[model samples]
Structure formats: C-alpha cells, structure tokens
Target chain A: MIEVRGISKRYGNLQAVDNLSITIEKGHIFGLLGPNGAGKSTTISMMCGLINPDQGQVLLNGNAPGIKETKHKIGLIPQSIALYEELTALDNLSFFADLYNLPASQKAERMEWSLAFVGLQDRAKDAVQDFSGGMKRRLNLAASLLHDPEFIFMDEPTAGVDPQSRNKLFESVFELKALGKTIIYTTHYMEEAEKLCDRVGVVDKGQLLALGTVDELIEQYGGESRVHIKSEQGEESFMTANPVNDLMTRLKGLTTVENLSLQRPNLETVFLNLTGKQLRD
Target chain B: MMKAVVALMKKDLKLLFKDKMAVFFTFIFPLLFAFFFGSIFSSSGGSQGLKIAVSDRDQTEKSQAFIGQLKEASEFRVTETDEANAKKLVRTGKQVAFIILPEGFGENYGGIFSGQPPEILVGIDPARKAEAGYLEGSLMKLGIKRFELAFSDANEMIKQLDFSIEDIQQSDDMPAEWKSLLGDYLPKFKELTELEIAKQPEGSDSSGLSFGSDGDNPMMPLKITKEEITVQKTGPRNSFSITIPQGVIWAIMGCVIGFAISLVREKTLGTLDRLAIAPISRTQILAGKALGCFAAQAMVVTLLFTIAYFMLGVRFDLIKLVLAVLAAGICFVGFMMFFASITKTEQSVAGMTNAFLIIMGMIGGAMIPLFAMPGWMQSISHISPVKWAILAFEGAIWRDFTYIEMMTPLTILTAIGVVTFFIGTRMLKLKQS
Candidate 1:
C-alpha cells in the first residue's frame, strides 16, 4: 500500500502537480486517468522518489519512498523500453535480477518464470533490438516483476502496444491482483481504466476530479442512460430518468420503432460530464 | 554493491564486443600504427649508422685506402659517386655528408716534413652537424697517422742538431764573419727548432719519437690509448626499441575514446536511467564502468606488446611491464570517465576525446621523443598522463630502470587517476540530476 499526501511540484513557471493526494490499497489495481500534461507522470515520479515534491511527502507503507527498505519493496516500469538492445532477452533479465541481489539458486528459476509470464520464453535468446514494439513492452513489464516486489508502479506500459498485446497485459494485471500485489497504473485510455482498474481516479491540471469504482462514478456524475430510436418517418430519442423497464414497455407498443438501443453511462461520458471535455483531449 | 558492479561491467563488455567497430578501434588500430611506424624507423638500420658519399678524384693509393677504410667501418654506409652527385645527395638529405678528394691530392700530400697537407673537401649538410663533426674527427685522426708515417726520423734529427749547434757557437778558431753570422742565426735557429711534442691522438702508435738521455732509440714518453664503454646491455640502441612504448600509449588512448563514448551512448539511450532505478548506488555504476574500461585498455596494451615482442624483437622485463600496463590502464580509464562527464552526446565526447589524446600525445613524446623535444616542452610534458605512461613503459623496456626509478612515474599516474576519478564521479552525479 502507498500514501501520497498533498504533494505539489513546480517547473519554473508551470505547476506540474498541484497539491495532489491519493491512497492506494493492497491487492487492487488503481488507475490514474488524465490527458497529456495532466500531472499524472509528475505524481507518479514523486511516489517513486525519482523527484522531490515542493509541498508534501509520499510514504510507502511506513517509510518514505527513497528509504532502502521501501525502495527494495517496490518496482518501477518506465514508459520507455529501457532494456539493452545488443543483449539477448535472457541476458538482460539476468542483469536486472543480479542488481536486486537475488540468490544464485533462485536466479535461473525467476528468469524462467519472468520470461514465461511475458510470453517471451521462445524468444529469450534473441536480441531485444529484433523485437516488435509490443514484444518489447511485454519484456519491459516482465523486467519489473523479476524481483517480485510487493508494489509496482507502471507509467503508460501499454501506450503503443497492439490490441492483442494489450489483452495479454490486462490478463497479467488481473493475475498480479489475484496474487495480492498492489499496482498503481497511469494512462489516458478510458476503456482500459473501465475494464482493468478496480478503482479509477480522473486527474487533470494537477488535480484529481473524481475517485470511485466504475459503477459509483457512472451513477454520480454520469447523468442518465438514454434510449435511441430510428424509423422511416423520423428519428427519436428519450432519456430514462427513473427505471429502464417502463421505457422498454413503452417502446414495445410502438410498431413504428425500427432501431432501438440503450446508451448507458460509461467512464468516457462520466469524464466528459465531469470535466466538460474528452479524456484524450 | 559489488555484485551490481560486476553485472554492469559484464553488460558493458558484452556490448563492446558486439560492436565490431569498437573492437577494431580499441585493439587493432593501434597495432596497425605500431607496425607502420616500426617498419619506417627500422628500415634505416637503427640510429647509430650514418649514410655518406665519397668521390675518389685523386685516384691515388692513399685516397683509395681512405675510402676503403670508411667502407669497412660498421658505423658508415659509404657510397662512391662523383663530386656533383655527392653534393646533390648531401643537399637532398640522401646522405649525411659528401667527401671529395681533389685530383693529385695524394701525390702532393705531405706530413710535418712539408709545409702543408692536401685538404680533403667535405661538403656536409648543416642540419646534420653531429654526423659531420664525427666525420671531421675521423679524418683528422687519419691525417695524424699520415704525419707519423712521413716524419718517422724527425726526432733523431732534432737531437743531433742540438749538439752540433752548441759546438759551432763555442768553437775558438772560427772566422770573424762566420762567427758573427752564426751567432745571430744559431739563437734564432734554437728558438725555431725547439720541439715540444704534443700528446698523441688516441689509437696512434708512439714508437717513432726518440728523445731520451740513454740514447738507445728513445721511446715515446707518452702513450694515449682509447677505450669505449657502453652502458647498454645490448650491443647498440635503436629507435624501434623506444618507439614500442609510444605505440602502447596510443593503444591506451584508443581505449580511452572507446570507453568514454560508450558512457555517452548509454545516457542518450536512457539505459542509464534504468540503471539508476535499480536498487544500487551511483558509485557502484561508476565503479563498474571504470573497471570495464581498465580491463579493455590492459588487454590492448598486453596484446600490442606481445605482438611487438615476436615481430619486432622488442624485449621487456615481464613483471615491470605488467605493472606499467596496469598503471597506464587505470590512468586512462579515469580520463575516460572525466571525458564522459563533461560531454552530453556521443559525437561531442568523440571529438573532445580525440583532440585531447592528440594534444597529449604530441606534448608527451608519443608523436616525438621527449629527448628530441625542446627543453621548455620537455619540462611541460610532466603534466600529461601520456608522458608518465611512456616513461613507465620505457622503464620496463629498454631503459632497464630499477623498481625505485619506475616508482616515480607509477605514483604520479596513480595519483592523477584517483583525483580525476573523484572529480568525474562528482560531475556524473550532477549530470544525473
């Protein structure tokens, strides 16, 4: 578990992160969603002890993020592919494993598990330069898990990955939660947050606008679900303020109705309603 | 911490070996330079021998004999040519000097009995003053020998004249005119004929002079004998022997550039940040890089010397050579770190490291021997690491310096390495921020 308390960071004239605070519980996927320059990365950087905050502090369990004990308990997977291109995948993994001071007896077994987890066991001997973007992303994820830290911080780990690789990453995240590991993931993808994150926090301009489960967020600021109908004569739509059963009974009595569908409130609509803009904008 | 350092060093070495260009520049390029320079210097058959041209215009026995003597001397490479050609050769630097014997010179040649000896015309290159002076001294010795051969009985004549002149002055029955004329003339003659024999030239025979009270063919009172003592254990010194150490310095320089640029490359590629995120300290990363560079340079120095030992007949003290190589390697690795810290990009690091190495090489006696440099430059060369490196290596090689003598350079180099490494690491930490 991690706790960030009212942290703010400034770069010359711009306030990158403005008095931001959040709490991540154990064994859950906490997604920080925002557009470009939303201070998401700046906040994550403070939490990882990579940079200092101007106004507050971050605590990992009980100690500060930079303490030796806390540093060993967490893992950071940066947005860039930081593996050596000239070395084989296995060699690259082995190098990071050594840095963590893993035991000699456990090194080979951990490397095997890591490569398999990333679905790169067959290409373990190939140089990383020859890997595709998605493959490299998978390898980057695998490297962060080599030490099996209790907490993991990922910054846009699936930014450029393909759909299939994205699905695989989702499965891996679910599996990590199943193993009782805490993960703080940051991204601008609304659908990924809706599907993968147990709890989501919408942030923009160094401020967190909302925080709750998917259903709670949709219920509060998401407005209402609408019924849309299109016929030969004209097209009509209706907003269901109360119950969807009364609207469905009314729609069945009209034979003129051609196309009918329910447009439910989702994270994208909730973000738009909350910030008056799209999540990606 | 040490485990992390080793892991980092292993990764760096793997990347270096994977790059063919890096391996070639680090190990093979210096060997090529050594071979080229060695062949050029050795082609002249060492620095002791002088090339000269001689023209026998007199064609007399004495002139021909002098030419033959010069040809037989191991130190001279004598060539026979006309006066015009000899002068041209000397002027063009093809020969050190031109010796021309005038026609009828040997026929008119005289020793002390004659008023003057025929002069041997020597047209020497002004730039080659040392070689010209050596040749002039040789010819002077030859002239002295000719004088002894012509005036073998001159000492006996002088002794007989001393008694006769005294008897003539003391005679009582002499004529008035004869006495008056002999009296003035005898004093003048005594003053003119008073012989004070000078010391003989070295290696010259002293049996001809006879001036003793016993009158039994008086032997020469003084004998001058020349004996040459050389300090070198080997027969003679050569330029290639000294040049081998200079070549090793160049190889070390190559290592400096190779390893220094690698740090810049890693920074640009973002791998340095990745390393930072790992559970290791900044000092460990720097230590890893320094160790890697040292290993690379040490290997290169050893390889170059081993090749020189077999191909160029370069000999060294094995233990001293190993120590010198290690010291030089450490010093340059520190230089590599310092260079990497100041530069931001690979291109900048490469350009700066090259300029630094070249300037140091020129001032430190790699491009030219320190002994041959001007006094001011030699004094300033002490500040350069390359200078210390060459000194240490030469101590191991031909200089045959004792351990105490070698320690001066080794200590200075190690000190510089330590200071530079400290400064470099501090700068690297600043840059990381």
Candidate 2:
C-alpha cells in the first residue's frame, strides 16, 4: 500500500502542490490527472522522494519514500525518455540495475526479462540513439522494471509516443498489474487513464478536486448527457439526466429532422467539468 | 554501493569515449600543444648545435688558435666568414650572432692581467642581443686557454712574467703601494722560476715542471668546472620536459570542462532526476560523476606522459607522477562539480567553464609562460589551480623534487579540490526539481 496524506509543497511563491491526499492499494493502477501547472509531476516527484514535501508525509506501506526499504521497492519512470543515448540498451539496463543493487545472480535474468517485457530484447545491443521514438519509450519502460519494484511511478509514459507504442505501453501497464505491482500513472490523455487506471484523481491549480474510480468520477462530476436534432426550425441540442427519455420526448414534434445523435458523458467530460474549460500554461 | 558508483563511472566513461571532440581535446590536443611548444622552447636547432658565424679578421697565430678552439666545441655550429658576410648572416637571421676577431686581437689575446681587454667584436642584430652575449662569453672563455698554457713552459712563463713586471712598473692606475710591492715581487718570482727551470736535468721535456699527464695544472689557480645538480635522476633533457606539464594541465582542464557540461546535460536530459530517485544518497550520485571525471583526467595524464617518455626523451618518477595525477584529478573534479552546480543549462556550463578555464589558464601560467608575463600577472598565478597543477607535474617529471617539495603543489591542488567540492555539493543538495 502507498499513502499520500495531506502532502503539500511550495516553491517560492507558487503553491506547486497543495494539501492533496490519495491512497493506492497493492495490485492496482492509480491515475494522477492534471493540467500543465496542476502539479502532477511535482506530486509524482514527491511520491518518489525526488522532492521532499513541505508539509505532511508520504508512506510506502508505512515506510517513508526515501528510506532504504521504500526506495528499494519503488521505481520512477520519468516522463522524458531519461536514458544515456550513447549507451546500448543492455548497458543502460545493466547500469540502472546495479544502482538498485539487484542481486548479481538475478541481474542477467531480470535484465533479459525486462527487455522481453518491453519487446526490446531484440534491440538490446543497439545504441538507444539509433532507436525510434517508440522504441526508446519502450526501452525507457524496460529500464524502470529492471529491479521489479512493487511500487512503480509512470509519469506520462505515453507522452509523444505513437498509438501503437501507446497501446503497447497500456498492455505493459495491465501486465504490471497482473504481476501484482502497484502503479501511479499520470498523464494528460484522459482516455489512456480511462482505459488503464482503476482510480483517477483530477487536480487543478495545485488542488485535487476529485478522486474516484473512472465510472464513479464520471457519474459524480461528468455533468450530463446531451441530445441533438436537426429540424426545419434549426439544429438544436439539450442536456438531460436521461438522454433516451429526453431524446424521445423532445424530438417528437421535429418532423423535418435529418440527423440525430446522443452524447454520453465520459472521463473527458468529467475532466472538463471538474477542471473547467480555461486553458493552462 | 561501490558497484553503483563504478557503474555510473563506466557509463560516463563510455559516453566520453563516444564523444569525438572530448577524445581529441583530452588526448590528442594536449600532445599537439606539448610538441609544438616544446620544439619552439627546447633547443630550436636540436642536434645541429647552436648556430654561430666567425669573422677572423686578425688572421694571426693567436686569432687562428681562438677560432680553432671555437670550431672544436661540438656544442657550437661555427660558421667562418668575413665581417660583411657575418653581419649579413645575423641581419638576415641566418645565424644567432657572429664573432669578429678584430685586427689587433692576436696581439691582445693575452690581455687579462691589464693590457687593454681584446675587442673581439660581435656583429649581431640588436634584436639578437641575448645571443650576442652568449657569443662574447664563449669567445672570452676560449681566449683564456692560451694564457693558461703559457705557465706550462719556462720560456713562455718568464716572458709573460717579464711583461707583467714592466706593465705594472709603468701603470698609473695601480696604487703607489701596490706598484711598489708588485715591482719588487715580480722580479723575485721570475728569478725563482728561472732558477727552477735551470735546475731541471738536461734534455728534460719542454714542460719545465711536470705534475705528470692527466693531472691538475699546478700552475693554474682557481679552476672552475660546471656541473648540473638535480634532485635525483638526470632531469629535463630539454625544453620538452618543461612544456609537457603545461600541455597536461590544459588537457586535464579540458576534461574538467567537458564533465561540467556533461553534468548539466544529464540534468536537462532528466537522467540526473531519474538517478536522484534511486536508493542512493545525493552524495553517491555526485561521487559517481566526479569519479568519472577523475578517471578521465588520470587517463589523459598517463597517456601524455607515457608518450613523452617513450618518444620525446622525457623522463619522470612514476610514483611521484601518480601522486601528481591523483592530486590533479581531485582538483579538477571539484572544478567540474562546482561549475555544474552554478550553470543550469548545457550552453551556460560550456560557456562559463570554458571562459573560466581559459582565463585561469592565462593568469595561471599555463596558457602563457610565467616568465613571459608581467610581474603582477605572474604573481596572480599563485591563486590559479592551473599553476599548481603544472607545478605538481613538473615536480614529478623534471624538477626532481623531494617528497617534501612535492607536498607544496599536491596540497594546494587537493585543498582546492576539497573546498570547491564541499561548496558545490552543498549547492547541489539544495537544488529543487
């Protein structure tokens, strides 16, 4: 289990992360969603012990993040493709594995397994600078899994990745869950989180405004469904709690309607509703 | 934990090798600096000896003997020519300087005991003033040989003694008491030498008094011989030995600058951030980075010295050189870390580190030789690590410094390393995400 309780962080005058809180159980995926300055990376950095919280605490199964045991079981897949481009894939993995102090006996096995998991085993000998963007992304993922830590933090893993690679990453996340690993994933792609996360937290202006399972969050903050019709009067749309009943009753007198459609609320709708439509830098 | 640090070093080293510019600057560039500067400062003529021209206008027995002596000295490449030709040679820079034995030089060659000093004129360009001094000194040394030989023969010594008696008797510059004293003693000395020669058995060799062959000249007083004193082994065979340290320091500085920018690059590339989350403390991460730079510096120093010793006639004490390399390593690694701390971007680190090193190199006597700098600038070199680093290397290579003497430079380098590293690490620890 991982717990972030009333954690807050400030940089000069900016409140980068407010007193936000979340808990993740073992063998589950928790999505941290936010705008550019919503403090998603800052929260992940705090959780990974890369940055210290000014107030409150983060505990990985009651062990503070920076403690040996906590750090030993934690891995952070930074959003950027954080890798030594001049080094071959195997070399990069070997270096990171040594840092984690994985047993020498298991180093080769874990390295080989991690590479295979990310589908980069064949390119292990190639320098990362020669790899495609998607391949580097996969190698980046492979690097994080070398130690097989129980708690993995993937901060925008699909960022700038092709769809095929994104799907591959999604599959890898699912596979991580099946392997009984807890994952804290952050991304701007709502659909990705909608597909992968068991729970999602929506934050804006350094504050967590909503946190729940995908369906629950949508039901709680996704606003309403919409019904649309094109008639002799003109095209018209209306929001309703029940699109089926509202569509049937509101469109009964529309004789010359050429098109009809219903819009159902989803995570994107829930995200926009909770964070507002204003753009953030 | 050690393994982790080693791993980081290996990665950093691998990256360095992959960088062609770094390899060239670290290894090849220093060698070039040493070679080019060494050739210029070391005896420029190398095996051809010091080039000089001789214009023997006297054309007399003593003048011929002086010229012969000059030719026999293998250290000089003597050129015999007329005064006009010798002047042209010097003016055109074909020769360092010219020795002109003036018309009356033969008669006045033995002028040491107060006939006028012979004017063995030197025709040289004023720009060659230092070389002209060398030419005059050499000529003077050769001119004294015939005078020294006069004592080995009774007739020659008696003649010289008689002339000296007359010269003193007629001299106005001599104090009255001195002239009176020498006027009385020279005759007595001459009479004693004549009597001694007459006492020798008939048909004895022309050397009236022989201490036998290959012995000190009993007649000659106050013989001075030159010797070279170094701390241990034969020191600096040539200028190459002196300039090798200069080149090595620059290469080491190159390594420092390269690693400083590398650290900043890692930051922007996000690898540093990734490593920060590892179970290791921030110190270990920094240690790993520093170790890599240190290793690079060591490699550069070793490579340069090895090449120098095998090919360039340079020599060094291996143990002392190792001490020097280690001290320099620590010092520059601190520089790398400190520069990395203050510079946030790769461009900033590159620009700032390079500018700082170049300035330090200038003021430190690495880029510019200390002797060539103004007195105040030379004094300022004391504060630059570049000066100390070069001094440390010189101590090991040719200065033949004792262990105690080596401490002066090694301590300074290490102190710089420790202070800067401590401050830099403190700043790094305070870095926010």
Candidate 3:
C-alpha cells in the first residue's frame, strides 16, 4: 500500500538515504532490516510525511505522503515512547483520536478497543508518567491505532520492552496483518522480521542490498544449510551442499556421530551475508 | 482545522493543570509579591502634611498675623516655638523647615515701596528642598498681602500723581522750565511705578489723561489669587492600589514563561513532532498552543485581580478590566510563542524567558513604579510590553480613564500581540523548514 520511489535524503555532508526504492502490498508486513545509520528510520519518516525526502517522492496508495487523505490512512509509532507523560492514558488516546478527525461517537468505542488490544484498559485512568516502560510502549502503540489507520509504521516498538510485552506486541502485529492491514516494520533484531514479515528488505549504507521472502533470500544469499555433529572423538560442523534428506541419511551411517542436527538458513544469516557483519554508527 | 486546534489546546491545558508547581507560580507567587510590596508602598491616603516650627521674634501684631496665616494653611502642620528651638528642630530633622521673624522685621517691612524690606530668617533643612521651597513661597505670599494691606491708600495717591506728571510733560502749553522740572522728577516717578499696570483708556490722549485719586484705582491693579481644584476625587492611592496592576503583569509574565518552557519540553520529548505528523496543519498546532497559553494567562490575571479587589480594596471598571486582562494575556501569549520559536531546548527557553520577564518587569514599573524612576528610565519604560499592560490595567482601575483614554494602551498591547504573533509564527515555519 506504500511506494517509495528513488527517495534520497541527506543531512549536511552525509547522505542518510540514497536512491532507496521499496513497495509493499495492501495486506503484507514488510520488514526493513538495517544496522544503525542504515537510513531505515529516514525512509520510514519520509513515508509517514514527518520529514520530506531531499529527492524523489513517497506515495501512499498513489497519493503523496502528507496529503490530507493519505495522512489519515497512515499511523506512525516512533522509536521513542511519544505519549504525553503528564496526561492519563485515556486523555492521550482521546487527543490523538481527535487529531485524526474521528467522529465523536466512534472515539470512545475505538479508544476502548485500542486500550484492550494493548492490555492497558486497566490503567487507562492512570497517568502515563507512572506507567512501566513496557506499559508505556503498549500505550504508545495503542495511541497510534486510535483512528485505526490502514497502514502502520512501527520503528523498533519493542526496543526496551520486557519479553512478555514483546510477545504481546508481536501478537498484535500478526493480528493486524490478519485484519489485512499493511505494516512497515524496522528493527535491529532479525528474528522479529523472520517471524512476522511476509517480505524482508536488507538495507545498508543508504542502499537496499536485498529484498525477498525467507526461503528466496536464504536460497540466493544464505548459501546452504549446515550440519553440526558432536561425538566422543570431536565436534564437526560442515555445510551440506546437497539436500537436507541426503545429508541426514549420509550422517546416520557414521558410527562416530554421537549427536546429529540439521541447520536451516534463516533471515539473520541471510541479512549478515548480504549486509556484512560490520559496526555502523 | 479548528477541531484539531481545540484538541491541542485541551491537551495543553490538561498538562498545565496537572502540574501543581506550575499552577502555584502562575497564580499564587505574583499575589504574594503584590501583598508584600503593596503593604510597604501604600501612601497614607492624603496630602503629605509637612511639619514646620514657627518663631515670632518680632512679637508685633503683623508678625503674629503672619504666624496665624501659616497655622491656617491646611498643608502645613505648624508648631509655635522659640528661635533657638526652631533652629534646633530644623537642624535635627524633626521639622521640615522653620520660620523665624526678627524683632525689627515688622518695622522695616513698610519700607518696601521706598526701600528694601528687612529679610525674614528661614532656618531650613537643605535635604527638604520641596518643603523648604513651599515654606518660602508661603512666607512671600504672606508678605505681599501685608504690604498691600498696609499701604493701599498711599499707593493709590502715588499712582495718580505719577499719571498727572506724565500728562504735564506732554502738554504743548507747558513752559520749558516746567518740562525740565518734569524730567528731573522722571526717575522718582519710576520708583513710584506699581508692580502691575492697568490697560489704558481706549480713546484718551496722553495730554488729557485723567489722574483722579479714585478709591478703586490702586497702584497694583491685578490681584493674584490661589485656588486649588482636584481633577480626580478618588481615594488617595496607597501602595496596595498601585501594585495591583503590577501584580497582574507578573502573573501574565509567569504564564508566558511557564508555557514557553512547556512548548520547548514538548518539542524535546517528541510530542510536538508526533502532533506535526498527524493530519493537521502547522497553523492549527500553533494556534492551539497560543490559545491555550492565552487562556491560562487570562485566568491567572483574573484570579489575582479578584483577590486584590476583595482583600486590597482595589476598584475596577468591570468591562474595561476584562478587556485589559485579555489584551495582556494575548500579548504574553505572543511573547511565549516568540520565545519558543527562537529557543530549542527547555533550559535555553527557560533561561531566556526568565531573563526577559525580569528585565521587562524591572524596566516596565512592574517591580517599581515608572513615575519613581528617572526621566530617561521612564521614557525607556514605554518600550516594554509590560508597561503597556500595566497602563491598560491602571486605566480600568484607579485612573478613572474613559473608553477613549483607555484605547491608547489597549491598542498598543493588541498591536504588540499581533506583530509578535506574526513574527513568531513565521520564525516557527522557518525553523520547521
């Protein structure tokens, strides 16, 4: 539901995003994988109309980003928890709901559903300042969904959240996908992208290095699955260039193999192979 | 657009009310300052009655009469004393000044028309220049009245004889010897000339001028009379009344600084950015913030004035007072927005806002009355928005200003609000870009 075409952004002498292009279908979860300073947030900012790209354009369902109609259909959950600490959870939700121009009659019902969806319904009357970090993260997510925008952009929504809250957030993301909502997710963690995203794009140095599904990416850049074996003699690990069934059958005949396991190429290996394991700012 | 603006305004107000410290500074602190300063500065509610010692060494009826006149003066609190004590009182600052009449003063006073009159000894405190000047003026006026009373008939005779001598000099039938005699008397005629001259007759020639010694034709034709008329008969202004508007200015300034800091905090916390990303225009966001700050300022000012009205006996023209409060609120809201536009962080905005408020308060007569400052400082006071605010408020309160008179300050305040708001919004747009 979003199209980023030849978009490039620069900050002073540093090019933040260089000629980046990406497209997502209406009901898919697209994960943008990148290291720090990889221009992932910059691209998301351009798509949400928060920051204008230095060159090219961002179109949401054929309309430019920040066009009134397009902005009404997009929601952004920033990396930081952007809820008003001084205001109660309900007040914050009500404010964002009003900003989206939601009808007065629908605001309360929608707010109730959003609070329940994020498991913050019990503390809706409490000030957000007194909330736990995880609770605030959930409230931030809930605040974004107040108007139920069709396209949601989440930038590391679970960065500091507890594991339980992280699981809850993941479940919420999957539920949004099941409801046919398009989401653009960016994170430092590769496992989340592998578990939730329908298509993954690996970006580095302001450039897109690879874009594909889990299997497609693994086949293209991840090479082959490896077999690891441990025995009384010594531990041995090797890449199985053949099919996993043949490799397993060949390993079963070895008398020295006391332990056996088949490894599969995942999104992390694919991401590392394509973007390289290098430190970035 | 208005809906979004209203939502933003609601959020701001909510945040402000939730902050207890903000509420206290915005409303309570200024009133406390007003009460403290007001108690110290309130006048005694009447003219400053000057204390003076009077010593009548002459012991004559004329001297006694002069002393009585000084006692009868409502502005002076006169005490009869000996010359030694009078001098001692003035020296010790127990009295503003003292009047001492010498023994031969009444005897030599009648020589004013022919020779110099004896001087009256006035032992005065140099530090009390205003009181000393008043005392001197009072004595001079009394001396003139006594002079006029003592020589009324003699002065009239001198004026008539002088007029006759002038007519004789100009006559064609007069002999040269008589003309020379008139020339010899000319210098003495000038000595007899009165301090005041009446307008001459419309058609009378100089040679035929009338020189009759009429009772009404005195040497000094013009009479000088002192009459005092007060334009505003309101109660005497005490420190409380004067400080009421000043207190209101402080409240408005506090609101401005508080909200300006809040805006910077929101920007730093990413709340402002989140709002910007919504389906709302930049104008809506700014308008919302301005409206919120304006409302808070107006509420604080109103609360302060209400307390002042009941507790301090401050009077007001209800409608004009409301308008003045609104104008001040708008002006400070514009100031808040302007400060927010220029500063990036909460610390920077807070520092600048405090400095600006204190400087404006000091110069604008909020901390001290403008009239008490030097002439140059008073002139510079007009450049402050706080000065215009205080002026507008005073117009509604004790100044008894009419609607037309009130318009000058009100218009100035409104203009400041408008111009600052425009510039602030433009700067904000540029910053955003």
Please, what is the TM-score per model? 0.78, 0.79, 0.75
lDDT per residue (tens digit) for residues A1-281 in model 1: 78889999988899999888888898889999999899998888888877778899899886787766777778788888878888899999999899889998788888999999989999999999999999999999888888888888889889889999999999988888898999999999988888889898889888888999888898998888888778665677787755478576776757687787788888888889988999888
**Per-residue lDDT of candidate 1, residues B1-433 (tens digit):** 7999999888888888888888887777777777777678778654555788999899998788778877877667899999899999988889888888888666545323222467788888677678878888877766665544543444433543454456556777777787777667745644543442334345544445433334233323235567997864652145566777877788788778988998888788767866776788888889999988888777788788888888778888999988898788778888999999999999999999999899999999988877779999999999889999999988888778899999999988888888888888899987675
Candidate 3 chain B, poorest ten consecutive residues by summed lDDT: B204-213
Mind giving the per-residue lDDT tens digits that candidate 3 earns over B1-433? 8899888888888888888888778788888888888886664546665788889889987678777877887778899999899989988879888878888776556444332476688777577777777777767776776556543444444544565555666667777887777667754654443312222354432231123444243445454577988786674255677787888888788789888998888778767767877899888889999988988887777788788888888878999999898778778888998999999999999999999889999999998876678999989999999888888888888778899998988899888888888898899877664
Docking outcome class, model 2: medium
Against the true structure, candidate 3 reaches a TM-score of 0.75
lDDT of 3 by residue, A140-207 (tens): 99988888889999998888999999999999999988888999999868788888889988888788
Candidate 1: docking tier: acceptable
Local distance difference test scores for all models: 0.81, 0.85, 0.81
Candidate 2 lDDT over residue span A214-244, tens digit each: 9999899888888888888898888988888
B-chain TM-score for every candidate: 0.76, 0.74, 0.66
Off by over 4 Å in 2: A224-226, A231-234, A254-256, A265-281, B31-127, B138-234, B237-251, B299-318, B358-378
